[model samples]
Target chain A: MLYLVGLGLHDEKDVTVRGMEAIKGSERVYLEAYTSILGVGKERLEAFYGKEVVVADRDMVEMDSDEILRDADKVDVAFLVVGDPFGATTHSDLLLRADALSVPYTVIHNASVMNAVGALGLALYNYGQTVSIPFFTDSWRPDSWLERVRENLRLGLHTLCLLDIKVKEQSEENLARGRKIFEPPRYMSVPCAISQLLSLLEEEGQTPAEASSDDAVALNPATTLAISASRVGAPSQRFVSGTLEELSKLDEEAFGGPLHSFVIVGRRFHALERDFAVRWAVDKDNWNQVSNGVYKVRD
Target chain B: MLYLVGLGLHDEKDVTVRGMEAIKGSERVYLEAYTSILGVGKERLEAFYGKEVVVADRDMVEMDSDEILRDADKVDVAFLVVGDPFGATTHSDLLLRADALSVPYTVIHNASVMNAVGALGLALYNYGQTVSIPFFTDSWRPDSWLERVRENLRLGLHTLCLLDIKVKEQSEENLARGRKIFEPPRYMSVPCAISQLLSLLEEEGQTPAEASSDDAVALNPATTLAISASRVGAPSQRFVSGTLEELSKLDEEAFGGPLHSFVIVGRRFHALERDFAVRWAVDKDNWNQVSNGVYKVRD
Candidate 1:
């Protein structure tokens, strides 16, 4: 039996109980590392699952899936993914390969970013579309994502902007020359993304899509953006909500560290959400309204 | 400090070890239940966390966030959400509220479906926009999603169709009558979603979107869908890939149970992904060679 298990978002213990069972039962365990990875290291997962996990990079999974599937036919093999097993096409490919070999397989899904963007109080149903903002280069920065965000805003839909991550990426020259050179993995920051977005809005000629509501929430390319930085599953994770301009000026020191993402608020902000946003708006009083309640401690 | 932590996709185990530590250390732990839920039940999570969790519904969150934020000022508090905290905007609102109150807070992120959809080998970067296919009533079905999907198709980008889920929603009549009423939560199935899509396409006097793609992979409105059905994060999880028509005829007995989603393959199939999809194509041997290694996974 081949088991494809998701290792939630954080450290080792994020694996579901069923996934844990599969890991324990499997004759061999392979952790697919390229698709996505836990904030914590592999050793942490190994310590928690109490199993030695073979780290499978893109080469192993994409170039040598047959080897992984071959063992599945004879033994209960478990392939661990950082998010949902089917979260990446490569993982799906792995499943297809397993099925081709007539190996019975089960996918143990876990939380992925698709559903998690709701943390900003935006209705999941109200989000029109999601697009990734890639790191801008001197000559090859793209603005296609900006147009999509415009459409979502015009349609009264929120836009979830996924930042890009460059992992084990090879330069065109390296590939052509048959050299196994790789660029350092880089996760895009919110400021970098917003800057590129600004340039896109300029290039696209500033035509913001219209929204369903009477209010036109478009063309505010510099509108309020909710930013979250270093949201590792760790207790010290940090989130900041402010206008894109304010966020743009955010000191890297204040945001703390890497893996930052930004959200462009669209139309259809409920009155309740507006009230909440007001608290973070520039120069707002009664900030203490957020502090007038009872408290409880579990520990 | 206030902590908004994502519980990932499944059960208590889905919470990252970092999230677990935060929960263990927090003065209080409140599970936000209204936005979305883990595949596991409340009781199961409580048992695993070994803590008395306060269930905070929408009413408690939207109407009573002050109470939670106030506590955070004096002590550490953790609001647990399914998937990533930022996956939903309500959590973002909560963070903004916390910020206004001078409450130091953090966000522990998890995997949400946003980036996880790469499982279909669809380049996350290539996706133009995402649209939600809501549950259509006898008289109130909306076709706006169709227009949005059309725009995306024109741009040659993959679309992630998020099916709708109506939970704890009241009926129109109930709101007018001022009576406490409830409606059953409805999760949109891929077959029903396609049926609506086709109907709406015909209504718009447009050619069926499926016709543009190769017929084998193009799922007409009545086609059975390639559905991943099961408690994605739970133990008995299952993923079944099939046609929209075939999936529509699926015996409930065979699909296993609730919480199902479908992936509509886009036109631009990557070479490796096509290879994988061919293995699952309806006619494995007579597969269309889109590329060297890419094939659509058929139902």
Candidate 2:
């Protein structure tokens, strides 16, 4: 049996008891490391599980999944993912491969940012299609995500923007020289994502999608309310809500570390939602001033 | 400290190791039993954790929360919630009360249907605002959820319909008599939900929301495709896909038991999603005919 176990967000203890039992009974365990990272290291997990764990990078899992599923029909093999097993499409692809090979598998679900973002006091059901924001380069900057956010905003739905994490990436120079050297890991911070979004809105304002239409409105950084969540599901997690313009100028130290997420508040906020969110406001007085006019139906 | 720990979906073993540790160290443990339920009972969880577990019903949680948190500030109290602590806004309210009382608390995240629904092969990011379907009565039938579904369908996004479960509910007669008598637990099955939806659509067709034009359309049961999932995150879980008409006529026995979820498939479908869905089709040939015409792209 091939068991796709989820190491829920945070440290080693986040793994469910059932997941731990599966790990104990498994002959071989492989941890997928590229998609997301745990708060603790592999050694800590090894110490807890008391089993040797093989770290599987993107190349190994995407290219040589057969090795991961080898002899699964005869023995229990555990494949661990940082978040929920199906959080990423790649893991679903792996499940399809297992099905093709006639290898029975089971998924152990855990909390992922897809759901954990609810910790910021936003109702999960009020969120629309989630979008990912990739790091923008000097020459290549994509604005497809802006359209998604726009659609969600138009529908009065919150938008969860999953900031990108570039792990084990190679520099252009190293790639050109055929060198295996990799660059340092980079995780998009809240300010960086806000800056990219601001730039995209500015560009869109200059060149409207349709020339015939003069009502092509852009997202206002000064009035758009957003919540910046850092290290969610961790002990030191922090959530702060404010306008995009106010949040964009926030100190880098405000957000402790990696794994930051942003939520663009929609126009329709329930009184309870607004109340809960105000408690996490970066500047309580400013938030009250902006939210009084922004959020619908004051309590 | 007050700890809001999630006992993930499914059985007692679904609780995280950290949750188990908290339970072990907690002086008093209260399980919130109204929002959602686990496959196992309180006794099973009690046996697993070797601790006494108190079940908190809607009344206790909504009305008597202060009593639950009376000594929590000075003692280690665990308020256990099925799925993630933040899955329901009520729990967030409880956290707010804890904050008001100056009680430090920690949240232990676990899998909720919000994320576990991804096991059905649909991309989580493609899902729009989720809606809940309540048991329809002669006078209390609501079609507000239909608008949410329509919005999602218009955007080509999947709609996750959370079926309502009535636990420890009192009848109007019993309530009027001021009796403590409770009705048997009622879980909304897939067939019942479809019937309600179809009836609502039929009613909408007869009397349109506004008589401004005749172009206001309603969902066609015969052509709509949906996926019925039962006991998700459990070992005996099942997922079946078929046209809404066929699914509506399906026997209740086919769905097994309680905790069923329905997903109304949108217009857009990636080939991978189509292929994965077709694997669980009630009628493979019919599914192909319907999906081929329904899914936007072949690839």
Candidate 3:
């Protein structure tokens, strides 16, 4: 049987009781590395599962998925992922391969970052389309995500911006030249993302449009945001709040490390949520005022 | 300290180890019952956590949040949710109340249905504005979600249609007279959702537009979907595959029980993903034939 288990956002312990059981019972365990990295390293997962785990990079999964499924058909092979088994489409490919090989499979689900964004106190239902803010290169800055955010704003829905994380990604030149060089994994910070959004809005001449809408009245340079940093499921989980402009101004020391994401508040806000944002306020910069009763309307 | 923990989908075992610890350590544990419910009931969670849990209904939370946050300043208190703590905006209000009471708060995140739709082998980055298809009433067959879905289709982005769930909802007469009459919690099924979608499309006269748009290829009844039913994190978890049209024909027996949701596949499927879908084909019906290759491009 092939088992796909989600390790969740943090360290080894973040795996659900069921996921741990599947990992422990498997004869061979492989961790899909490129799609996403766990807050903790492979060593920690190995120690917790009490089994050696082979790291499966993009090459191993894409170029040699057949072999992985072949082995699983004979013995229980567990492929562990950072989030839920199907969190990324790549993992679904693995499951499809297992099914093609006539191998019995079981998927053990766990928390993934997709839903974890709710930590910012936004209603999941009220959230519109989620867009990923990629790290901008000197020559390439995609404003495609701007249209999505605009639509969500128009619908009075919150937008969950998943920051980009590039791991084991090869440069165009390196890939064309048949070199094995890879850029370092990058996890976009919330502040950097907001700055990019502001820049894109200005570029598209939508700065005024973004600012003038009643839904976007709370957003500005000094507008507050709930930024979550650190490994969520890890021991050192951290969350901070500040305006978009102030968040960009603060140094990395305030956020403390990798895998950070941001939430852009929408027009509506529940009284409790507004108070929650106030606790994470950036001192005197309080341009983003949540209205009196935002949660009164039921979705 | 106040802790908001996500129980994830499904049963008690679905709770992350960190969430379990928090629940065990808390002096008082309150489970929010309005937003969503687990596969099992209060007794199951109480048995698993080895602690007495109080059901914080909507009225209790809206009217008497202070009672739950009263001693949070002194001792640890946990508010358990079906998905992530922030999945529903109500918990954010609870946190704000805690902040107002000067209670240090922490959120233990978990996966909610928001992103779990990626299980269908669709790229998370390509999903556009999500819409909620509410259960239609005699006088209120809302079609607002249709416009949002149509907009998403125009942009070649996937639409995550979150089916509505009605829990402890009152009848009009009961609400008008202020009575305690309540109906059974209702979870929107895939069939009902599709029927509504098709009817709304017909009403809008966008059937041909939706059916023949080269740009809106991702929006189709035959588009691949992850039809998941039952408690995802529970032992009885069940997931199936089919087009919206095909899925709408499935009976309750095959779909299992409550808390069912689906994901509509978007364009831009990876080559590896296209090959994977071929293996999940049931009988003579192929998902690929239904929803032509949205991934094919001349680049």
Candidate 2, clashing residue pairs? none
Chain B TM, every candidate: 0.83, 0.94, 0.89
lDDT of 2 by residue, B3-49 (tens): 99988999999999999999999999999998888998899999989
Error of 3 at A117 (Å): 1.0
lDDT of 2 at A291: 71
Give each prediction's DockQ, rounded to 2 decimals.
0.30, 0.67, 0.48
Listed per candidate, the RMSD to the true structure in angstroms reads 7.5, 2.9, 4.4
How does each model score on TM-score?
0.71, 0.95, 0.84
Candidate number with greatest lDDT? 2
Which CAPRI tier for candidate 2?
Answer: medium
Ranked by lDDT, the better of candidates 2 and 3 is: 2
Ranking by TM-score: 2, 3, 1
Chain A: TM-score in each candidate? 0.84, 0.94, 0.88
Highest DockQ: give the candidate number: 2
Q: What is the lDDT of residue A39 in candidate 3?
A: 72
Q: Candidate 3: which stretches are off by over 4 Å?
A: A136-158, A166-187, A190-243, A265-275, A283-285, A289-299, B172-181, B202-243, B265-286, B293-299
